[model samples]
Target: MRRIYQLALLIFSIGMLTACGDDDKPTPKPNPPVEEKEPMPDPISEFIWNGLDVYYLWEADVDALQLKSGTEEWKKYLNGYGSEYEELFESLLYIKPDANGSATVDRWSWFIYDWVEQENAFAGISKSFGYEYRLSKYSDSDGVYGYVTYVVPNSPAAEAGVKRGDIFVSVNETDLDVSNYRDLLYGNDSYDLGLADLDVENNIIIPNDNIVTISAIELTENPILLAKTLDINGTKVGYMAYNSFTGTDEFNLALNDSIGRLKNEGATELVLDLRYNGGGSTYTALILASMIDGNHVGEVFNKRKYNDMLQNYYTDKYGESFLEEYFTEKIENWDGEQLASINSLGLSRVFVLTSDWTASASELIINGLRPYMDVVLIGTQTHGKYTFSITVKDFLDNGEVNPKHKYAMQPIVGKSANAEDNTDYGDGFAPDYIREEWDYLGNIKPLGDPEEAFLKAALDVIAGNNPPVEDNMATRSGEQLETIFDSKELKPFGRNMYDDRIDSKFKDLTK
Candidate 1:
């Protein structure tokens, strides 16, 4: 009876423990698996929107754009389009309306699909047939023709025996016109360019059987075209025909070498020929200014003025010292190697040869130096670009460029001024001595030639000769050619400005 009672109690205890265990085991909860949200599409458009909204100089003036502040709404607006962010960007640009309701300009803002390509172009590197040409009529009713002005060394065009004076009457047997020349010569990598020669007797461009087949390839340019110290009049002067301001280590070394040679030659005066300079780097412009006048290292070289918000933001973050750039005698090359100290003429005045095409950093040199010295302009008006830009890419929180798209926006972000804070060159810096070379249709001369129109004018001015009366000296012994194309079509690239924001700590803040 005792054993039976003990076994019964033990079994009861076991049953109670089993029941407790069963009660302690919580009921398995029924839950659905987590779902990962699809990544937001078209991040590049967001980048464009963010970049332009924050950094563009005329951000407040952008009309017709009611941007949403929330991420969902912004993405919704972006998705409303079919990934054509370029058109959206174009639409978002600040356009100035005329009285007639036509938007005359949004000219400065630009977009680049491939930031790599834009970077290469800014560095004075290009992949093409490698020749710079001008489209113009040689004589009245002679029809439009392409004049080969510059052929890069070791380029396909140079290898094909195309010289500077060679003329092209057609491309792939199609007569050259304003409508077709750029498309034919620059549009494609490979094409047959038809040759032409000047018929002095007939005042026409006669076609020839010579066909030059050209294939495009990458070519790095040497921007220093000609640098020499010439003894003209009674003064020793340094003459440099700089084509472009490519701010690369190789370009800087060459520029330093040129300046060193000028110093060694004891050049008391300087005449910088920038007739063909379409401009490139502003830092190089600063270095060149230092090379011309190294005596003022601590003085303000330039003052950058951003849009109101950015100006306040930069001022608060970087202090008042941020807006000003002082001169420096020492500069490092792109390789981080110390470049030789800059040389200077230390003159009270400098002469710059200009044309309508002389722009950007070239103009920056003209404007930035005026507060310190006399800048004598000796050609036609300039292209009148007074803005600076930065390469803004779509970057995520990790500080990496977003892999979703490869679009880059290079919008005009700010206006620059000299120490005197003068930014008024909108109509271009009118020449102290004006010589319009464009009116003289057939008088294209080699750059370094002393007899060249602009150089001669500069020499005549330096010799104390009074400015000559306006006359058609460019008229060759032929009929005046009727120009079918505008002179602006000859420009290969527009003016460019690199970022002037010196404080790297606040660099990403602007973007």
Candidate 2:
């Protein structure tokens, strides 16, 4: 009976324990949990130019874009012209917008492969077959006016029946100021036959209604301009203005011979004015740099980089893909001569005149020369591109040949030590003796202007040597290093492992 009563009491206690907890505190409500969001993909990863694995330039949290379908919003332009564009979509890269709907880019990823040129260069093209023209400063007819006393024979202008006596009148209704004419006609004057009716310049023949203005419309005809060397203050600056770097071998040859002649005739300072040199053949680059750096000829200071992945690329549903077979089939691209030894003109003092149009190899010469010689870089801060690139040749998977390109890129890849050996210029080499920052000095001065200032300043410092603002180099001692001498005498000659074998053998002999 007592056991049964105890069991009943135990059951009551158990029920009380199961039903109750803390009586002092009221029950509190549980807080709701927070949800997490997934991270976005890096746009740079989506961009692969022929498998050129340019990584993420910077980290970013992108904003929403406006698009109808595939989820990408914004515009992309073609990079360069010629084969690379037709095949590799080299013109366009991917991009992500920011918080304010503004498009953003980094070295890793721009909306297109051509972004650097588009944002930086004076002009860019959808197709890049090397051709240049001159905009006439005084154009009355369809021709733009420039000094045409030395047009190359059999050139487009020579074939078109234009001559030295002719002053360019107008080109497609766009009149050129004498200042920017040389590069304008060749660079800024590409016309699409398909877009004839939508002519923005009204320089196209649109049926009969716009006949008067259309009369000035000249198709893609690169004119040959004539020039003769003019003496500049007895220095014989050899003022042959090159409109473009596209090789007219005969023209360049004549120019070179003329320069040599100028040297003989008392042209002490050779001013190779490339302010208008928009760029051309690497073949020509060596010849030109050879003329300038005459002494230490063939010192290969710069080299271009080539990647097979970037050589032949095709776009797929997933993204861009590299062509191994194509790249392997023909590894040899670009002329071999371009990689030859660097040239040291060996000039104690060099004065270079540059402008925005002075680019590519022109910039390369400037940077490499700085480490070895005393140079006074005149003109504006250069185009700031100190690099080189090689042409890429590739084939498709099925052995079909795709369009190719110069595979253009700046590959100086590192800051170069200049000829003078003081410092290295990252983008563009600033002049040792800066006159004034003239991004557009040539525009303000006459045609033969940049050299004028550079020559004046250079002449002042030519026969003299100048010292650096300061010199700082490591001179200390520690476990890694020890002093070689104490007060101009050898200190005890404490031989270590470096000299162990020889030192021990010679110990008895010395003693």
Candidate 3:
């Protein structure tokens, strides 16, 4: 009986083992379906600072060394001085391998300095002077924050201010620790600010520049000047906010037309608001200077880099020539064309409102007009970026296909100046006055020390004129905004009661 029991148990164990084996062979449940891995992004080429892509450049002060490869005589001259950059200059000159001395850029090469400076002492400096500091303004990388960037020309700040690698500390006096400090600076005509208390722990002030506190202070905008006509006493005072000269012919035509209308409307004096104008074209400076100067004035003579200037350049991202095509047939001559043409408006010296943003072109107007008329530059010191530089921005690649590997780099290649001999104001243009004024939050008003001084000075000058005329800006009919709306295109607004009121005031433009 015991043997029978053992045999039965063994048989049962074998049967259980067979059942388990069969279960394991049944399709293995598909292993839960494996997941797929994603592929990585492809590597592309990159650009570097040192490359062969400089299109625009300030006329360089290159020694014969940079010009050695032209001819046997040229090579002899360059070799005499021990040089090696012949290949590149040849490319710019469009010369073949065997070409000699036929470079024609000299005709277009502008005089770097006034008569007093030495010849080619340096490549293009008009004058040589020393300064302790230079006040500068520039937009942040993203262009949101426009810094009142100042640099010491020869002092430690000049030598060791913020290094290229160090980012500037951006702050607002009103909010103290916050960014967008300009909030304390913009205002609506009447502005006032009282000095505020300081904080010990944070080392910040309580009530900062009032203008900065106003919502009007923003650095991200294009910062071009806005126009506003005002009524002063009985005279017609034309208020024009002149910003950058970068605008095309359309903008200039509008500005010139506005000036003409104002003159015809009986405006005795014109107020040009240049608080936000960061200077631009040489042609632009000439046009503006013509209105201010009594005669053809040689304001500044700049040495433009790249004698082969073709109006605007063409690149993948930025294109030129569009401005020329749209606004004008060609660039107007700075010396004769612009000044001669604009002066036809029948006006005298213009009262211009200036600020730190009043730079290169602005300075030219001031200096150039000095030779032609009495130009009262009433403002804080101008932006000292007197040394004009040509910067060429290009994309460099990593010798591959993907565009992501590219980088944009800019190199300063040339310099500029006005008709006057003076060019090297490395620190900045000095304002006739530097008093600080602020709105309620302590944000500076009148656009800083320079602008405030210029405005008051101009008003004073105009006020003291021989005629001693009363302010007549309020009564001007031809140049009035009311008349501007009288145009057929804009007349549609007349359907409303507001248009009727305006038409009554300005309908008779010729009078």
Candidate 4:
């Protein structure tokens, strides 16, 4: 019996071995190794694309910006740009020339190579010589000359004795003209200004022997250039020459103190001089408008209009109140913390001094206050900018700016309108009384001086001395000089109006 069982076991083992060895029997195959994709080479370009796609004011107008995020096509397009991120950015803007070779819109959107420099600029910090000037062409020739408008205290320019009304016809002893003025004045960190005198009678510039050597150094400008109370014919007229709308803590405090002083001095009327203000924080604009007239608290100051996607998203998430900015009774910072109760003037009429450089928040003050008071303008037409932008950067998952690159974008994300829905002032707001400072360069006066051209005009209007039509025109000798450029135009934050609230309100969208 044992021999028979051993024979059966051997036979069964042999059959199993033969079946395992058979070639026709299939063997189990291991799963193929998973493929891995290479990471994106240029994150800066991706950030630019995503940001513009989500926040550009004219997103629908650009075909490339309409691509779905993270799709293969979008990824391909983003990779195609490689290191030419600036070209990609320019290509996506809505200012493309039409068949007639004219740009359609969006002349203010720009890219920042260094966000640190940009943030500093927004806070009124820059590497500057501490002086502002206006460039004008010689009435009789093609040469150009610049006159010092104001000198910042303790700046390099101020240390070098540069003062208001100082004129310069050359930089580093090189004559300035239409072709080389920009390069000569702004191309270097240090330059010697060849002093000159404006001979108004001959409409020519006379070069002087004096030369002022100035260097660019990091400086923070106080936007409150001049604030004083002028008693014009028994009427207390407050004159404030505010240069920019920087909304820093220091700036807010300074503005509060200035207004407090004006209020304490028994000012019944205001003449806001925004001749050199190129625009700044919308929040600052709201605070300033509130300070100008406190009669309407919680009333609509201005309305914001965004692209369709952001509009619908904001509307659905935050309701209508999110789109409108209201006049507040208290001053606050970007975090919504109350800094101080606003020192409001509560006046019903205000006189604004404007120029081609007065724009953005400056214009907002004029337009927003028109419904509540008499906003009489006294200078040239404004710079005609109705849109606002926000700084967009590549942010990591931790809400920190990506340290890999310094690229940032200041894209026009929305348009601003007054409560009456009045916007699109492309030609700018015309002054009720025209007073062109460049036209009277020969007779420029100190900012707060009662005899100054623009301030005098405002005071005259306030004292019921509206000059006749013919008398309002600026008197010039020989050929009339043409204004070529403004010193503020060369600033990195050129004619910018920014909404700082977007950083907190739309944080998720940027992410």
Please tell me which predicted candidate would have the highest lDDT against the true structure.
4
Is 2 or 4 the stronger prediction by lDDT? 4
| Candidate 4, pairs of clashing residues | none
Per TM-score, the best of the predicted structures is 4
* Residues 321-398 of candidate 4: C-alpha lDDT, one tens digit per residue: 999999888987667789899999999999998889999988989888888999988877898999999998888878
In the range 18-121, model 1's lDDT, one tens digit per residue, is 88795587788989888654346465666777777778888878753345534565656666665787877776777856679994445667887887777787
Model 4: number of backbone collisions: 0
lDDT of 3 by residue, 1-511 (tens): 9999999999999988997895566654656666553232111100111221222243233333233223454434323322223333333332223466563321111211121221111111211111111111222222221222222234222232322111222223222122332342222312222223423344333443322211111121121333444444565555555655543454555555666666666666666665545555545554555544424433232323222332222222134322111112222432325422453333456665555556656665565444344444444456554423222112223333224322221222234444444556545555443322111111222322223333445555555533222222212222211111101111111111000000011111110
Write down the TM-score of every candidate.
0.82, 0.42, 0.41, 0.89
Q: Scored by CA lDDT, what does every candidate get?
A: 0.73, 0.34, 0.35, 0.86
Candidate 4 lowest-lDDT run of ten: 467-476
- Kindly indicate the candidate among 2 and 4 with the higher TM-score: 4
Q: Which 10-residue span in candidate 2 carries the lowest summed lDDT?
A: 493-502
RMSD of each candidate? 9.8, 20.6, 25.5, 6.6
Give the range of the ten consecutive residues with the poorest summed lDDT in model 1. 499-508
